[model samples]
Target: MRIAGAALNQIPFDWAHNIQTISTAIAQAKAEGVELLCLPELCLTGYNCEDLFLSDWLPESALAHLQQIRPLTEGICVVVGLPVRLHQRTYNTAAVLRDGEILGFAAKQFLASDGVHYEPRFFAPWVAGETTTVEHAGESWPLGDLTFEHLGVRFGFEICEDAWRPDNVRPACRLRGKVDLIVNPSASHFAMSKTDQRYNLVLNASRNFTCTYLYANLLGNEAGRIIYDGEILIARNGHLLKRNQLLSFKEVDLEWADVDFSTPLEMAGELVPLPAPDEYRELNQAMSLGLFDYLRKARSRGFVLSLSGGADSSFCAVGVAEMVRLGVAELGEEEFKRRSGAFDEAKTEVVQTGAGGAAHQTAIDVDNAAETQNQKPDTANQALVNHLLTCAYQGTVNSSDDTFNSAKELADSIGARFFDWTIDEQVSGYVGKIEGALGRPLTWQTDDLALQNIQARVRAPGIWLLANVQNCLLITTSNRSEASVGYCTMDGDTAGSISPIAGVDKDFVKKWLRWAQTELGYEGLRYVNDLQPTAELRPLADNQTDERDLMPYVLLNRIERLAFYDRLAPAAVLAQLIAEDPAADAGQLRAYVRRFYQLWSRNQWKRERYAPSFHLDDYNVDPRSWLRFPILSGGFSEELAAL
Candidate 1:
């Protein structure tokens, strides 16, 4: 028997789009002669519908949509995931269909409630050894913990989180000797190096249960914030059979392998390990795909960036370039443009006229005659990038020449449309107005933070106007490290539609820029990578730096992980930091820890107001998704005093 698993990129409650992708996968699987096919968990309605699962109409609509897929399974056995509502509750279930007839439904017995997942809030766990019935279209089908037989072979399910449970409690343990195959449908979010753990889980389950195991996952940024890698795996009794290329820029990705259930399996060769994953490459692909999906699904024209020529903004600029490079490589140019929703031949004209023509006439335009033609003619990827990315250097009087060159060169190298404009005039106007209202002149010594923040804040309006004019998303440059402790200016640098690097820390951002410079061949990164990381909002005489304002980024990230990810208290975090960095001074470590806790407590409001950010790592500080804190709290004062 030939079995297959498909990873689908679906939109939430978008009936037409979801059904089209599902139909495409089923048609492709049937063409490949796959007898048993398993789709990702919640593929019918999409995985990230948030609170929509609570609505009876949504689940009823999903059930109605499932009927459309029934006829497509005329000659094949297909297992598709969807929410099955019984009584007043909902259950995450995989329905088995054989030759256009509903066989039965295997409901998930485990619910994921940890970071980035709140499944238990919406789905009730199916009781073990229990059977129920669901009625649809005047016909009833068996639902709840169940297995089915097709073509003399029996199979069971572990819908997404069910397989992640303990070996003793997971559904597969009970189906060990009872079933010949175990299929897992998942909507696992993408995180670096997480695939290795999943690979082991599937292969070990098949070996322990003495049955063939098949796994599939959802694809792309399905609804925003969460990215799915669209992985597919097939294995039999400890022997790996098939695995698809993960994070593909495709709507439907399918992989299959032949399994001989009647004959004895040979166990001569051990399961060959998948090549070690390079995190840099993984992030590049995940971010590229995430951006592509966001640009198209949000129905936005493109991305507008305030390219500060710093680490965070530089990383984002390169991300857009890589999006064009990787997307065009996978889906051809025309399809890539069509899927992006806003990229068209007219956009090319907009770039030539709007971006180019306007630059020639403004006094704020710092470009010389030679710099106006920075985008090369022969590079098709660059030309596509020019349409998709529009960047401006919103410089102040305090901005440096090195950063200006960094932003321009990098944008030019990647074929992104570049503009340079100074916000000094606006900064002065705001400062003078504030002085008149207060009847006092604000000096840097008395109001240093306000002085620095005004320069950053003044740059927001012009860039926002540019983004609005182009119908593009404005990219915010704040990363996870800055978000951890209120190192960022709210409504200033933090003002944007999306924060791409908000999940990753500053330490990683710096290293990634260096790696991108040498390995990824973005030579334009050399400028930013050479300079020290600074906000550059202060006068050059101050020689301000990020590490001076806060602690070293390495130590800051350590404290953040301990405090949030590990859920440590203030005293415990300080102890852990001292133990980890014993060579450093203990007093300064204590100071940094106290500062982190205070800033983190006060910044909850800022984090609450931050633009929607991607969940790239295992954890993030997004209150809506991973972590939640009160906007008003005690600020950890008592605990800090003890430290």
Candidate 2:
């Protein structure tokens, strides 16, 4: 029997679009002679519908849509996921339909609860080997974990999280060799090299169970935060028969393969060449796709950033440049422009190399552009950036001339519209008013934090105006490291619609910045890379650097990972670090550990207040998405005192 799995870019509660997309996928699968097809989990209500699953109306609406969709699956057996309510309890369920008839419902046995998933709150796990009749659309149908047969082929299901369970609740019938197929509908989000893990699970299951495994996933930035790579894998007898492209820009991506039931299966290694894990390259690709989808979804004219020429801001700017270059390369210039709200018939024309997929020749290679001077970048891809990204450098008395030059040169190199403005007088306006209220002049010696924060805070309004007047998304410029220690001002530097890179750490950002400059051909990035990471909010004479402000970024990340990832205490962290780095000073390490614990404890409120950020990896700092820490804590005083 031939089978198909479809990956879709679905929007939440978009009933009309969701119905049309499902119908289209079904028709295409039927046309391709696919006897059975599987789509991603929660394709109807959308996987990102967080609290809506609690609503009775959502389940009713989903069932209503399912009835309309049942007619569309006339010729092929389709497994579609949606929320099913039984006895007022919701279950994450997949309905099996064929020939315009409902077969049965396969309720998910495992609700993923880790990291961005909160499925357990909304869905009850289905019991294994327990079969019950469920009332649906005025008819009773089979529910619970049961292996069903269709046209001489036995089929079973392992919904999104079920397959990952260490103690799988598969009925004895399945292990006894009665099941010939295992279909999985997943809304798996993208993380660096996560596809490999999915592959291993699919391939191993198919080999061990002697069945063909079909896996499908959601695609793109579905509900603003998590990005789906739209992966579709078909593996049979330990061999990957077919796999769809990852991170596709299209709305619906369906991959199909012909499965011959009569062929004797052999347990063997994979024959296909598995791609090596290049997370840096993959990260670049994922970020570009995510930013583009966000821009389109927000329907903003473009993006505006307060570019300080630091790694964080440069990363955001370069991310925009990549969105245009890489997007144009893949979709072709016309399609990219059409999707980007660029309606000018003549404006979207990009020079195609006609060399297969390498259409845009301007991918950040330094040798490509020797001139560092400010001019409309000779690169063809710069035109797209010029149209989409507007950047400004808001300098103050404490801001250095180096950052200002770096911001301008980088903006000019990338063809982004650049504006230079100084807010020294404005900084004094607030400082003077506050001093007047206090009946005394504020001195830097007594009010350093307030003075520095005011400098950062003063820069927010003018750049905000740049974003507002231009109708663009103002990208915030704080990284995970700074965010961890509350190194950023509350409403100052943190003011923006989205914090794109806040999920990632500062050490990686600096590493990526250097790599982007020297290896990735972004010559403009070299300036930022060369400068030491400094907030520069303090006077130049003080030589204020981010490292001096807190601990070293590398050490901070290590201590954080040890504490958060490994769940270790302060003394344990110090001991581990000392053992790991024998040459490092023990006293310094202890001090760093204490600082990290104190800062992390006191800064939970800042993390709670950050704008919605991208969910990057397994260890996310975003309180809403992954990690949850109490805003009120003892600053780990007792934990530190023991050390």
Candidate 3:
């Protein structure tokens, strides 16, 4: 039997579009001779439909659309996701249909109602060991304990969270005597390191149950906030028969090899063993999928970066390039070439050949007219000058050359157009104008944050200007680690069309970059990953680092996960942290706790003002959607004081 997995980018609450997408996918699968095809969970109403699920007309409208789709399933078996009302209780359900007949339906057994998902409020669990019949399309369809037989093969179904449960639908099917196949339709959300877990879980479940498993997932941003990373796997016995790329939304086909279920358990087990490696491959897949969808669905051509020669920007740039490469590979050479348009044939110019030393820093003479055309004025160069002076006065060296070189190399390797703009003088003039407007000196001593913010804010206009002129999207370089504690300047480093790594922690960003460079041959862009992170606002001083300014990103990310996401109180969270580190002091603990709450509370306004970011994990901080803190709160001081 040939089974096809159709991963779709379905919009939430748009029944008509959902019907069209499903019908189109079914038609394509039928043309390809696929006997059975499975779509994502909630494909009819979308996964993140939120309160729309409670609308009085939703269930009726969904059933109507299913009836409309029933005729489209000619000569093929199709499974679709929708909310079903049985006995006046709503349940997340999958409806199986073949040849214009409704086969049966399975309700989701495990509802994810915690952390980012509130399914229990709207959906009741499917009670185990119960079988019920319901009327659908003028026929009685089994609504519970469902399994369908087609062409001598018995198949069972599950929804998104059901497969994640320890005693899930797949195992339930295994206990129901001799089922040969289990199909899962999912709408799992994206996170930096989630895909690997999903893959391993499915592989292990298929092997453990001794059945062929077909899994399909949703993709793209559903309902404007949640991103579903798509992956389709076909596993039989104990081995994976075929697997689609981790985050691909396109249709994938896997031909099933008939296997006798009566074979000895050990022999069948050897065919599909569990994934042995302990790495987070699922999270990597989620990141890739999020980036791909962010670019394609956002109608973006490519990305641009400031390339600060720091870990943050370098990691961001490499991630963008990787997404492009993956996209090209998935689309194939012909489609990629067509999408990118004509390639530039210009040769790369060698700049800064590493031969000139400080002694040979003689300014090259050029006509003032040519210099005027090539360079923006000294005022444009002020930010760099101020940065250099601050570094020099502080006896530390902060330069942009290394970062520029790294960015240039990365852009070249990725076949992206690279351009550099030196607006040091222009920026200096702008700073002077701001200072003149205020009638005083804006120095690090007087107002350090305001001073640093000005420098960062100045950089955004130029970068945005270049990105706009080149028709490329500017990639924001802030990471989850920093974003959690509000270390980024609003409309400065945080300003971008899309933030690729915003969902990942800073420590993980380093690890991922190292993995990409050492293990994945992403070597050309490693320089940025290796550099020490700094704002270059103050003259470089001994032991001056970004980590010192904010809490250690690793610790901050952990606290964020436990405190805000897991809903642990501050005292309890501190106790847990102390348990992890016995030597942690009261002062340090209180400081971290205070910082986390203060930054979190103050940054609600900033987050509210941010552009739409990719949602790759359950612990997202999107203010407009996932998190909703009031902008006028009294800050975390009161909370900390009480603690």
Leading candidate by TM-score: 1
Give the lDDT of residue 200 in candidate 2: 87
Q: Please give the lDDT score at residue 174 for candidate 2.
A: 48
Residue 139, candidate 1: alpha-carbon lDDT: 95
Among these predictions, the greatest lDDT belongs to 1
Candidate 1 regions exceeding 4 Å error are 266-271, 350-378
lDDT of each: 0.88, 0.82, 0.66
Screening candidate 2 with a backbone cut-off below 3 angstroms (N, C-alpha, C), the clashing residue pairs are: 364-520, 364-521, 364-522, 365-521, 366-521
How many residue pairs clash (N, CA or C atoms closer than 3 angstroms) in each of the candidate models, in the order given? 0, 5, 34
lDDT of 1 by residue, 119-212 (tens): 9899889999999899988999999889888889988889889888889999898998999999999999999999998998888888877889
TM-scores of all predicted structures: 0.96, 0.92, 0.75
Task: Assess candidate 3 and give its lDDT.
Answer: 0.66
lDDT of 1: 0.88
lDDT of 2 at 259: 84
